[model samples]
Target: MKNLNKLYILLFAVLVFATSCEDLTEINEDPNRPTEVPVEYLLTSAERQLGNRLYGGFDNVAFGMTVSQYWAQNEYSDETRYQFRANTNNTFWSDFYTAINDLQEIKKVNTTIDKGQQGINQNAVATILQSWAYHSMVDIYGDIPFEEALQGVDIPSPAYSDQELIYSALIDSVSSAVAAIDPSAPGFPGGDVIFDGDLSKWQKFGNSLLLRIGIRLSDVNPSLAEQTISAAAEGAMKSNADNAAIQYITAQPNVNPLYVSYVVNGRQDYCATENFIELLNGLGDPRIGEYFVPAANTGTFEGLPYGVTSAVAAGISRDAVSQLNPQVYAADFPGTLMGFVETSFILAEAASNGWIGGSAADYYAQAITASMNYWNITDGNAIGDYIAANPYTEDNLKVQKYIAMYYEGWQSWAEIRRLDLESLPAANLVEIDPAVNFVDVSNILNRRLYPQDEQNLNGANYQNAASNIGSDAYDTNLFWDLD
Candidate 1:
């Protein structure tokens, strides 16, 4: 309905028709099965769906939900080895294929390879999206269909690829295709509902993501991180406007994921982690005001530390503790899964490694600044004072970044896992007890397990992947998240 040059779907229909016209169309002579749709219509759907996918897509729910990023953070609890191992939400791989299929159709429509041209930009976005979709598939499933993916009816059970190779290809494709966007050219704008066909913004988004890739390999391959950052800086998102994102409507099907969750209505079943609130409150970070609404008539706003015990529950009423912090979960999901704030944090980490053209400290400061600004917390002096007065350290740097990324469940979850769940001294908070014996609490949180649908659909593959994972709930690490 809301097509910002949403052309992905039209292209998909065309491919479907052309491929099935001979065989399928002959049998099912009703005439609507395989049909050619306008390229414009396909692009509009692509743009529209991209916005949808960015905010907790099926792939996201599959990965994030399985990983405890979805419930544990909301429940303020931990995962058992079993809970994380055979999670029921593993149906995301199928959903990702759904996205890939749409994106590939869009790419096929723009078969031309003219750089700086409208068709090329459209194709480039599709390429970048394909790389992201594929990267996510492997990131969640370890090794998955890469080269032979999205052929749909072409290849039913495509062979999987190595995770490392998939990621490596993703890194290359993203940089190359994104860099292909020509900022200084007249372009068609219909297929670009997200950015109004602004090629420069597309370039910025690509670069911002490249910075993300650079930081992802920071621990695993430092030299690779350096090289990725150096190249990404060529067109990185310098300002918030360049962020590759779309604002969701508070109304209807476009509601934010968190917005739907925090609803008192049965649609949501999670709450904020005490760990998140206490850290934000302790740092006196202004974003907290923007994030949550504190207990009514408490006389002051306060958040319990990570892993709260009733004894340390402070003076708040019991009801508030067991529920989603009202201060944070608005009726709307204005929160972002990916955006300038996320990219800026990635850049901060990259800059800290001296990978790009700025001081680590400056980038870190700006990262926090972007977080605040994105949240509409515009007191520049307050943030400036916080940066000037506070000492910069690698730990605190990541801590603030961690706090800023709270709304982005997967990113924060990934960061904490990468950093060994060590709580930085950046915030003044008490120690987290491994043995938390609190009322209504079950266990300490850890990784999300493989989801259930995987068993029913990709049963054998899921079983094999699960066997390769370790047994420890709190200690297990992904290939890239290894200590």
Candidate 2:
């Protein structure tokens, strides 16, 4: 009986060893998860994710609108008050990284799987997007993971690159991307949500982006700025038709981010800010109704004071404050990444700096006309009148730029900060309700704080970045913001 038991145990051990030695990798693999996806699908996903990050409600309302003084919170005023919850930064950081990772994957697949002249075209598109994602990060956080970012399992803790260096690399990347495009080569038509696989438009968009970045360095690195601006102006966006924008559908997942925030979430948290509305109203801007709705109670436009406390906000009737235009808040409204209006403004600024050819006034007029056209303000007389009323004064240029970037809160805030607009005060211009606690009226926030996760997951890098920037406070100025 003992011998028989030993034999059975020995057979069982051999069976277990054989089973473990066999290729169980395939059996253990999850059927649902894909090891690789089509490049076109990845491209489409990257574009959608980028749009969501850029135009999403959380960033727009919670940070951008309040900082830019374009919109104010009706009830939850913590963000406006600059008392940001930890999760706010975390969410933004995560979303951006997710998009960045996908973009990186697109580049990888383009190089490895689709290597050819056709692959070069696709790779160029991916490279431009990667540049854009990195540029946006640098703009917001000053310095971020650029050199070794998206390395996956290879390098988990990528060191932060200097913002100046990142800007240089981004400019080179965009330039190379534009140069590498082969129009005759096959392209991912279905994947391109912005330009419909038009390599020419993509090149134009890259040049436009270059113009933006070049001008960004105008205050800090004037020589490089002049050179870059001059070069980019040669191929930058020429017309409103060439604008880089993403059109959203009426479907649930693909709906406009504003619609998701306002309708799906059932929240009326945002109202037009008194600062922005007063500026537009003062200018008699024809796009007022296109941007905001009339107050429900008075049937006239009214704006809420920005950065007010919850208690102060609670006292105001919701219907008395102007909400976003219904058209803007609709699910199908197109989200703009870059437009000719913005490019024109960049040209105007460059001309003012003597970095590019053409009269500043001409570019300024073109910008206004483009903006009007973008908003569907086709009344020729109205546009002509508005253009005549607003000339190319420096102050007027900055103000108009601010107004043109209404839905694009981040860009507006960046412009406001870059220009150091003394006219539009975020904190001290209009006195907040005395009842509002935690209001820091002394300092204006210039940049968003680094993500809190950086402190925990990447403590050493976080400390270095914070020290390099002088402080981790939202009031710290970026390198390019040296006025």
TM-score of each: 0.76, 0.91
Residue lDDT tens for model 2, 275-337: 777878888888999889999999988998877778888788889889888788789988888
lDDT of 1 by residue, 1-483 (tens): 558446777888888889888777578766674465445566556544544444442323323532323222223233211222243244344555675777777667566444347677776777765665565544444656677666667866555565666667878888888767776765445655556677777677777767776676778778887888888876777777666655555576656554554463444433334555666666777776565556444634444334443344433353353344453444454434257777766766777666777777877787788878877878889989877765567777767776777555556656665665454454332334446632222332334444456446666655555555543133445567766
TM-score: model 2 vs. ground truth:
0.91
Best by TM-score: 2
Clashes of each: 31, 0
Candidate 1 global CA lDDT score:
0.58
Per-model lDDT: 0.58, 0.83
lDDT against true structure, model 2: 0.83
Residue-level lDDT for 473 in candidate 1:
31
